[model samples]
Target: MGAVATLVAGLGIATATSANAAAGCRVTYANGGQWPGGFTANVTVTNLGDRIDGWRLGWTFASGQAVSQAWNATVTASGTQVTAANVGHNAVLATNGSASFGFNGTWTGSNPAPAAFTLNGVACTGSVGQPSQSPSAPGPGPSASSSPSTPPTTPPPAGDAMAAVAAMQPGWNLGNSLDATGADETSWGNPRITEALLDGIKAQGFKSIRIPVTWGQHQAGAPDYTIDAAYLARVKEVVGWALDDGFYVMVNIHHDSWQWINTMPADRTNVLARYNATWTQLAAAFRDSPAKLVLESVNEPQFTGSSGDAQNATLLNELNTSFRTIVRNSGGGNVTRLLVLPTLHTSADQARLDELTATFTAMNDPNLIATVHYYGYWPFSVNIAGGYRFDATAQKDLTDMFDRISTTFVARGIPVIIGEYGLLGFDRHTGTIEQGEKLKFFELFGAQARANNITTMLWDNGQHFGRTSLQWSDPELIAQIRSSWTTRSGTAASDLVFSARSAAITSKTMTLNLNGTTFTGLRQGSTELVRGTDYTISGDQLTLSAALLTRLSGSRAYGVNATLHVHFSTGVPWRLNLITHDTPVLSAATGTTSAFTIPTTFRGDQLATMEATYADGSNAGPQNWTPFKEFDYTFAPDYTGNVITLKPEFFADVTDGSRVTLKFHFWSGAVVTYYVTKSGTTVTGTLA
Candidate 1:
């Protein structure tokens, strides 16, 4: 039998009709920012059913529009029909609960909204709205009507800056294009800015926007580095759009590689002069604008490829101090305008945080926000292929990172902004990331960010969400992101009954012996798999209802592991008896003069016997297995489901780049023959 097993339940299997009856839901599609050729769109799904364990939404474009990238959902298209399946966190929804995702797409001549939508194969009740017009092309400059001299200003109230920072949650970034090469916003793929687009974002429930602008290209040469009036006006126009809609906006100098602010010692005078000149102009421009408009000193200031030194940290601190002094002296609302400062390369690493803490703590500004960018584990968050698993290790790493930030900064009255944090695309496909895994990543990331008083802003580089269509490329992804913000409040790991743990599934109807555990919240991955929709609990026995079993079986393949988490109202620690089913299959084996190779898909380190079986049915001596030498020998073997190299003298007859045939005997009474070949540093084996 495999890790998964089919068993006849003592109780009768539940019928699907009851599950299908509770499938009522509705969807709404809205346009976000867009360009002449491309656009962004967002879709929101509302559950009108009895609690749902999982959901899938479908729609078709009226025009010949092609989706380029997506987030928060697993999006796939066949002809004109588009399907968005719920990721892990947003899969479960109680009645009236909602989830959203966004995407970026391209349209040739016309972009029309899909007229209808269906949720979980059932037709949705609401009507889809028409696609709004894309923002017009950039003009020579903003018109007098669009650019007001005395804009309606309601400055953010003066108080503890950390309080203001705490109020800002779930931020969005206008990525790639606006901060693209030169001042031509459309130079990248994004469309012109529009009020309708800002309205769409506000409607989608984002409270903050980070506008990354490349100011160096738009400024004059030499001593003063005077910013062009037209470029400033254009930026001011966009900032006005956000401010008019009552959004907390942060604008910064992004991608000024030509200025070399990172190599500060040599270019200190020139960089500081330019920096001072730029902020002086911006501060004067929005001097009377609402306090909601924040000015970030610099974006990722660091020496190229170097993990910051003390000198670089000190230079950055000097630049930040200069920025504060310049802004305060510029007059008007500049005195109280919120300012964001970045550490070396905007890293959240311990060394950089320590330096930033030492520097920023000395500066006496209540309106200052320390900023950092978190890509975290590069293999999972930024990798383009495979390796995007949000498993136990990932959870721990992320939790620890956030906890460090909380202890080092937030606890000490320094508010932090995760200016940019998001998983990149896996290959070119938008839906390549497993929906459940991505959702779980967001759920934990959001929860940690919220708990730590750190605000998180998503980084969208035109690929994730379209600015032209003003609709999310992946509606489900946006929903998961939103759910993280909405559902994270008042929840902490200490409050949970089973904060982080995994249980195995061995039978069709398995019972979890909770050992007198009580929980107020229970979730499978990020989603709150409901009691009636997913399972039923009686006394200490938590039963996997047949409906859930059927759903799980259909959604996942055999041998894959699933996780469950619980929270308690009483804060009592809960005990659970875990059951594991590890039916080991023959993995791999190879040999060389200096080393032997054995690959496995198992977890943990366990010693076993290895023997050779001859063609004459004779067997060699059973050898006591040892840990692979190429791995970290200090710890127990880490079975990464990949090849492991061993240094053993027994296989010394085989040399590098050679082929050998051997029959391997396992301790489990299994015997198999394999043909192994080596090429340079690589070894491969196939069962014979």
Candidate 2:
């Protein structure tokens, strides 16, 4: 909160005020182009603010002259010279791009650099003097060397590109006890299952998403434990439907500390007034959520009042001083919340307690964070709840105990995140890594937690199998939970394309980047110009992300094909309700492209299930069109290793000239390549 000064005409320009980028941000400034005293000044950073992870550009120099030395990043000075670090490399630089760092100081009288200058507090724009001498430049242009230029610049560490995209997300168990009994959509944490574990995790690309939630079997301690208003308004309507279906949810207190840690009362004002009335009723119920509503406070906490090693480091300095007095208590839930804290037995690794380990200092608040968990060597990790058989020396002793839980929290400076490691893939799903080595160990630990920025989740409950409370939508397990979810918006080392002219459906583009940056999508339905909201191509399949066009604007409060949901891929049933809507409004409801066809005397598979009737209602109910349950039986001219690939959902490249009758959802023994090409009654095929 430090910007509000502007004088301009004489060139006073200096601003940096971010109470969260006012709304959106990519903010920059720090003298890589010059900011302080010698004053050549030119710094700007904006885009999706209000959620910063790294920025600290302070001001003031009546002359204390400190910061004389700095490096690729970290630099500090006493009373009045600030530069706070981390913004390079891990640049999500708010939506698109632009980064800056400053240097070159020394002022004698009138101008030394402050009328207002901020970077993480948001406030920038000052110009009171400097730059009118350019009009007199007629003769010899080589005379402009002003004696001040340090161009090399590199100052990073302000939440290091959203702490490397919140370290590469994946933390499950939301609205807990397996999403209060998963019916589907993984009961909101998302998990309808079957896009083959989400195209084997979007074909091996995973990014982030960690569900976890129990909130004491649905809060509502009625009146005071104060958690149950229809179970905290259905946990803020499923954390605003998983941050509007783009993932990154977190919401913990898992067992609700049995009522937020043993029912208050251990001094400190009745546990800081019941943890500030449970985070002021859960941070005013998700203060305009967007960076994926993450509020985890009390998932593991059970070590009991200090003992031994400096009272186990004074019980983690009284749980980091009750997590910075419940996140700098301004009212509750947390005023600019971003707290995660977990150590002691919840062990996110404070080096297994030897003493002095404690952290929480607020005031310098950038929305504090700290959480760490991993089952690592739990019987070849992915034993999926005592389902047994890790064999191979227990998968190399849980991969060297997950490389010692990733070399013990990637050597502090915190940001390791692994909320729940598949907790046990039940022998990677029914043993022998389900014939695929625990699903290629969740696709090589989601590219080793997006290359060690680490953020994981996969405790799965879609029915840990027939009895732990039933939830396993099947279909190769929600296509491996939508293939490790990291839907490319930025950094996963880049690779989420689609713009080959963006293909049809109305020129549906796609680019959702992160290293080179781009990401800004925003389209949902209706049809006007019908352009695909920033992205969603169909062919090679892409989403580019507008968080699914803000969940397709709630799909259908009315029409647009009346969508309750219809995302064919993000992997498995992340969502899908679109009954129909390209155009057609007859009291709405009924679509997957309803055209109507049936004459081939139907060949098996229960005559292709046929039932759909529409509003008149049929296909039994819960939406129709069934068939898919593992019907991909190879050989349709079979031989991917030799130019024979046909996957139009299964089959369709026909030139049938009326003499090409075929049907098979399961026929195998490879070799079903067909290649006819007539015209008369519509016929085309090419599988040789």
Candidate 3:
């Protein structure tokens, strides 16, 4: 979904006239999506020079274009020149840091890029500051960003925080429900919270529930900023139900992190006032609640207009200290309630971990826990930049982050909770990640968290669980995740084994991943296959004899004829599909750029991945780093419709009038080549 297209000729942007004060910078302007007479553009300004407090980016439109709407920054235009200033939360740009903003605009004649850009009156050249020069100014002094001289009165040791968090193993997030930003709780398409939903989760073996609440939209104007009594009551009702259901419940300030809390540095006075008042009301409302309840200071706390990390850390510490004080001083169960604190962005980076470590040590309170979030490796998690597999690179990223948390907090006697964990691509659609790869990610993610003595809460956001049906969207994937919490599951290099129907059947071999487990045997339904005659295992290699494959492919059926279940020494069994297929054929057709559908005879095969390339062998589509464009982004195979649809966004990025070759990879190990050319608004496709 993320695209970086080439700049059109004679429409080049970001040419600086003079170097000015700072070393240099770079500006990237790309078309995210386009349509007739209107389009959306994304701009990224990288600060390659010294750090800047507040920045104003200026550029000139080559064509007669006008900005209609913008986000992440304020865009204003005067004739042909346009300027974008940083917003409250994105005002500071440290060296090597970049600020991204997008806008929708209207264009006539042609949509040419700007010819130049200026950042704070200085031209951008995308160069680093000289080695001899130090940062323009040193970070804030300790006095400006230091902890409180006196720590809050440590709450009486009520219970072990470690035990409390540990008991919250395998948690579920009540996401997109109370956290919805619309008028009411059900504004985000999720059904209203019912006892039946909680019962279903409890029945599914979940020990904890995290309810994220957004109070800003429900509260009245300043001063008291009283949350609608009815909304507060509704939140209380849900919490009470979960508590009664014997689930460890966590409630926190959710979207306010970006709404108001992110403006802390620029408007600390009002921000902290509202923050404290909200928690005060919360403490009073749940004052006498049971000990199973926990309070999180903030959700991924962020700061605005800060010089750098040091100032940001200081500001966060101030908020955490205040939250501890307010809740601890309030009466009843608040005296020793377990509290959760997060680093900047709730990230696992070393600097963020270190900052949180300092906060825990300074608090010196036994009933405190640390929290962070995990979304797996960026590329693979989002299915971009050729990260289509959960290979060693993606595996190591998970290991390294958990290892750092294990050492920084878990090993230091502090319990760390992965407040939210899942694939970022899932936010768009589950199909964004391949089915097997997604399963492996969760399986390993659960095992690693358990090994590190940490707790993880899955971020559902209405994507995983069905509130109306009370059933999981994918039952098998959920089963694998739940199984990983207790033991290891064996998997293979892939879940698919392709057998071409047109060729003679031969012995098929696949390398097993094993994953710290041993393969027991293979089974079809309730019948077991013979060892040497049917299949053989040498080391981690698994071979199915041609005779066994012949029987499975009876009459050389076109499609999956049988599913073989692979049993392991422990945990859930892996499933392997034996699919029989032949080379697919594509029909040449014509259509507009908006919906250019290519007719195809799949011949009992499933789509794997697609690649696009030009004559020069350069990547020819979006995410140009790899020839393989995203699965559902650039082109999608609609098996039911028997057509492969090329999205409009893909054509917007392709060079007009150029022949682009498309490689369609099928699950049956078949590669079908097709070509398409875009000229003006018409597109033509031909099979190779």
In order, the Cα lDDT scores of the candidates are 0.59, 0.37, 0.79
Better of 1 and 3 by lDDT: 3
- Residue ranges of candidate 2 with Cα displaced over 4 Å: 1-171, 174-231, 236-249, 252-281, 285-412, 418-434, 446-455, 459-673, 676-688
Top lDDT prediction, candidate number: 3
Instruction: Show model 1 residue runs off by greater than 4 Å.
Output: 1-156, 257-259, 305-308, 383-387, 425-432, 488-688
Query: Candidate 1 lDDT, tens digit per residue, 253-304?
Result: 8887335565557767787788888888877888898878889988888655
Total backbone collisions, model 2? 113
**Clashes (candidate 3):** 1
TM-score of each: 0.56, 0.24, 0.74
The superposed Cα distance between candidate 2 and the true structure at residue 340, in angstroms, equals 7.0
Q: In angstroms, how far off is 627's CA in candidate 1?
A: 17
Residues 1-688, candidate 2: write the lDDT tens digits: 0011111112221222222233333333322222212222223444333333334444555544433222222234444545434333322244333343322222333444454554433444431122121122111222222211322112223345335435344444432333443333345453443323322221122334454555444444433557667766755665565444334556755554544454332443555455556766666666556544566666665534434445554545564565556545644334555556666555544364222123533324455555555554553453222222334464554455445545554444445465665634342233322222344345445545655555666654443322222223343333333333432112121111111111222222332212222322222221221326445545434443434433443433222222211222121111112211121111111111112112121111011111112223222112124212111111112222212222232223222232222222211111121222334433344332
Candidates arranged by TM-score, highest first? 3, 1, 2
* Residue 259 miss distance in model 2 (angstroms): 33
Task: State model 1's lDDT.
Answer: 0.59
